[model samples]
Target: MSKALDANNRRWSTLVWGSIPVVLLAGALTVDHIPGTDVRLTVPYAAEGPGPTFDTLGEVDGEPVVDIQGADTEDTGGHLNMTTVSVRTNMTLGQALGRWIATDDTIVPVEQILPPDLGEDEVREFNQQAFVASEASATVAAMHYLDRPTTVVVHDVVEGAASAGILHPADRITAIAGKEVSTPSEVQDAVRAKTPGESIEITVERDNEPHHETVELGENPHEAGQAMLGILMTSEPAGGVTVNYNLNDIGGPSAGMMFSLAVIDKLTPGALTGGTFVAGTGTIDDDGEVGPIGGITHKIRGAEEAGAELFLAPAGNCDAVKRVHTDHMTVAKVDNLPEAVAAMEDFAAGRDVPTC
Candidate 1:
């Protein structure tokens, strides 16, 4: 019995000692470093951490975060903050290892944040464009929720299609077939109301003036027999209500929800945040629907650190939020603009806000 016990102990010791080298080798490979060498590899990983938070309801550098021009905006008090995630890419092996062990940041593949083929400049430009588009959608969604006027603007015109020369981008479609149209669906429904080769008159606002054009409809590129105008249109705020997002540093569609909330609060009577700190992120469409965004965990940490009372997350991201721990703030799931507003009001009223 004593010999058997000694043999078992020896085998266990050998196994434990053997795993140490294999574990070190795996760790070295994970950090892209060679064992017992000075050589370091360029790791295709990025470290993401909590970034700075900006209040959408306040001004940044003497400029309002949500600048609404040509309107008598109401007084807004409180904070509707937007959060961001800072990413460090193209890390050296030693730096990667340091970040992996020293910080609470997430280390992920660089391709998750940026493309390998495109440079940082190109990625920044693309993200800025997406941010601009999200701002437009946020403005339109706020206006729609407030029952304000919206016009359908031509986004693009396809070549070799009917109305290609007549309709141009940036032209706002005011009416179609002698009927008023304000949304993209309205325009499409009116066009499809007619058959192919049918001529219809369209009224467009171009360069601050109305222009009339009569063009025959063409068959839908995707549908077999449906009629199409061959132009893509999007609904936007009309009547000189211009919304300018002030942040030039932050890029991406994640700020859409906060932008929409700020617009609503500014155009309405009372404060939406009730003078308390509230931070959230999601991509909002023109219909007030909220979509999920990346980097929710880091954003949560930032918001909690900023002393936010409530954090609004997309409904789809509730599962992700559940994995993290928030000590000070409450997390509420929002599927649209109304839900976000309700969450804020409930928190302000000392009601029980929904948790992740």
Candidate 2:
């Protein structure tokens, strides 16, 4: 009788512990069966929770995750972990119900992740591509942040296009609207943010001298009504300084910030964390601008699981992060790479860490 009462008490304790997430997940639960007779019904929702993290400053499979060549590398210590979210999709009803009461992970419509229009493999491919692109951007971003020589030059300006004579071929594009740009995609993304006929200031270096042009955007030849600069730009990293990322099966651009931090740590003299464990997530650009990412809470939990002392969150996710309750980790809001580095420095020096 006592054993049975203890079991009942434990069950109720768990239910109370996870009651909030249970209530949250109950609404999104829907049937999306895969025609399997083994299970009663499969839920269409996907669960996203903490996934395995990697220390970018450390080794993976006996190789440094961030391998920098032709430069003096720092002998770094502690963790500069990049967090990931473990996703559970196409779950059976039994699994879904168990998860609701067992974990604090979030469940959402599967279509939000794996859209109906694309297959899982295709989506994975796109994610991997984004990861590669972000890695390239992070490499140059770190270089640019360190004031190393990097260039984003106009390969060609399309004839009769918006930037026809406004942007000359071989012109080294410096910044877009005062924001430093070191990649062609940043230039493209900046232009795409505006509509046709919108004017933008494009700073460039022609004949090794500073210049700026205010050019009116033109409609994209491919996507109607969208803005285009009509100038093809190419990025070149600092010569002989190559960065190679050596982790696999991890997809998405969310690791961009951590990767940049790793690169910066490696090239610089002192470790950013100063032997302190740190974990963070943000999509960073070649301009060192940090952007928000999904699964913030999940990544936070992952960082905590790895015993991280500090959590570096993007300023854009301040509202969301402020809602979370953490036990011991110090959460700091960083707007860009410089801010992130400063946060780490502050934490290392035993200073009062900033929070959202």
Candidate 3:
């Protein structure tokens, strides 16, 4: 009898604990799925909460129209401030069901369905996962596109960097620190031989005329005991190999996807834009593959608010993204730009978008 009672008690405890989530889930689903109801809830920890999508007051094609600003723009909608319901549902399913079941309609809401606003604990976790996934995809694409580093010949020196003026983007450095160079490796070796605060003369050719400029090196960047010039050099694509990339004003590691796409698009023919205002956030590789991004749901909400007709997301985020989808926008899950482009074309043609 005692053993039976103990087993019964354990069963009751399990039933009580398990029912909490089930009941909450059911209630939330019932409310969210119903019609003539607004599922407006506050996301406390969200970076930018729901608001207008317009980032800047600008014009495209010289026509007066709103333009989306760079990713760094502060025009993002309002962020969730606290862990509370900012507004109540117009007709919550939970409340409606309870009203139908009894004379007195009293519905008890879930205790912790959503996280705290700006919840660093949870947001940090999500960022960590997102960055890891993005890094892996970026690594793969870079390896494919930048397979072998090539050298570019400096032809002109309009500005003398370290000597007097700026170095033009197209100018090539033939030799550094008085060393003969034909490849990028040789230039690097010559530069590496000099110590910080030392002056090095870089030889270059402009219009078949050779010239030299002396520059003082700066302290090591990021790591100690190393030397740097604090400037990036570029050259023509050698060996018939080319690279394409997309860049934005927001300079961070997160722009990997845009950079990759920009590079690939330059290498390929035609423009990616079909004359539509489509904004996206994701990491791209050198191979022109699209990868997952962080804060996708928030991004989706932002896209919808911006009047975007379609959204392209990573395949891995499809399931989670689907759960948060609204009828106001279309989300297309894809592993690369090719798939994403196809989806965009379909959406343009008024075809039904496939869900993840």
Candidate 4:
């Protein structure tokens, strides 16, 4: 009886030990954070002729237009490049572990990347709205640099927001409370001055005709005692100059600064890039303010791989910039559009520039 019991015990121990390896293997393959990688930035000027992506300024109504140069210059070696990150979603446990071991990529919880309640369609819609906002910001920046009048227009209305049914996409908000506004902050201030649930008069220009609508203000979800209209706004050229951005599939406002720079480069004479490959990522506003963006480390890697010698990083993102491998590229910290342009000019002139 004692011998038989010992044999049964040995078999049980062996089985338990064998199962440990399988469990560990399964855990290793489990999902973790999304992986981010570099995507090449394309300049729209490289496109054939003027269309949805490229814009060429010409005489409008017999008025002389800006003499834009560098469309045909072959030796113009510089590029106003934008940066993007490749996200790896629903990764297995083993794959996540591999990414962690590689150290070249980052791991983030799924919830951190996206809200748990958001569906795929909602996410896509959000991305599309972001793209529109970026285009508007870029257009405004360029128009501002050109000293042209611009207007802040509604790009997309957040679903379930106060303005969802009251406002539509592409509707240009001309004024709030009978006072004309041009920038987003002005509109916000106009709304914030009012109490939540108060009705405010909003004038929007659609199809070249003005229409007035009464919108009830809603409480700002982020701030207490603040009123919000629940719409995404963008800048549009009030003048005859038109800027059309044609990059498809790519979303987010991170490319705003780069797009603005690209437009400025095309509108002005000579190469703003200083004849060297330059890449950057930042959210630009109509007021020329630069805002921080995510996936900057991945963008840095992308710029480095694309043969970019200079990188323009938003000042707010210095911490992430410090943690990334910049390799041989010079990373310059910029707070606004003017500073960015100056840094690029300084680099092209072989002068020392600011670095983060």
Q: Assess each prediction's global lDDT (C-alpha) against the native.
A: 0.90, 0.87, 0.49, 0.75
Instruction: State each model's C-alpha RMSD to the native.
Output: 6.2, 9.9, 15.6, 11.0
What's model 3's TM-score? 0.36
Residue 336 accuracy (lDDT) in model 1: 95
Predicted model with the maximum TM-score: 1
**Could you tell me how far off, in angstroms, the CA of residue 276 lies in candidate 4 after the best superposition?**
0.7
Per-residue alpha-carbon lDDT of candidate 2 for residues 135-159, written as tens digits (9 for 90 to 100): 8778878888888877787878889
lDDT string, candidate 4, 201-270, tens digits: 9999888899999999999988988989999877777754566665666777888888787777766677
Supply the global lDDT for candidate 1.
0.90
Query: Which regions of candidate 2 fall more than 4 Å away from where they truly are?
Result: 1-41, 153-234
Q: Is candidate 2 or candidate 4 better by TM-score?
A: 2
- Highest-lDDT candidate: 1
- For residues 1-356, write the lDDT of model 1, one tens digit per residue: 69999999999999999999998766655664455776766688999999999999888999988999888899988789999999998687667778999998999999988887888999999999899899989998899888999999999999988988999999999999999988888898998999888998999999999999999999986888888889977888888878999999899999999999999999999888987789999999989999999999999999999989899999989888999898888999999999999999999999987777
lDDT of 4 at 261: 79
> On lDDT, who's better, 3 or 4?
4
By lDDT, the candidates rank as: 1, 2, 4, 3
Q: Write down the TM-score of every candidate.
A: 0.86, 0.72, 0.36, 0.67
Worst 10 residues of 4 by lDDT: 44-53
Error of 1 at 26 (Å): 17
3 or 4, greater by TM-score: 4
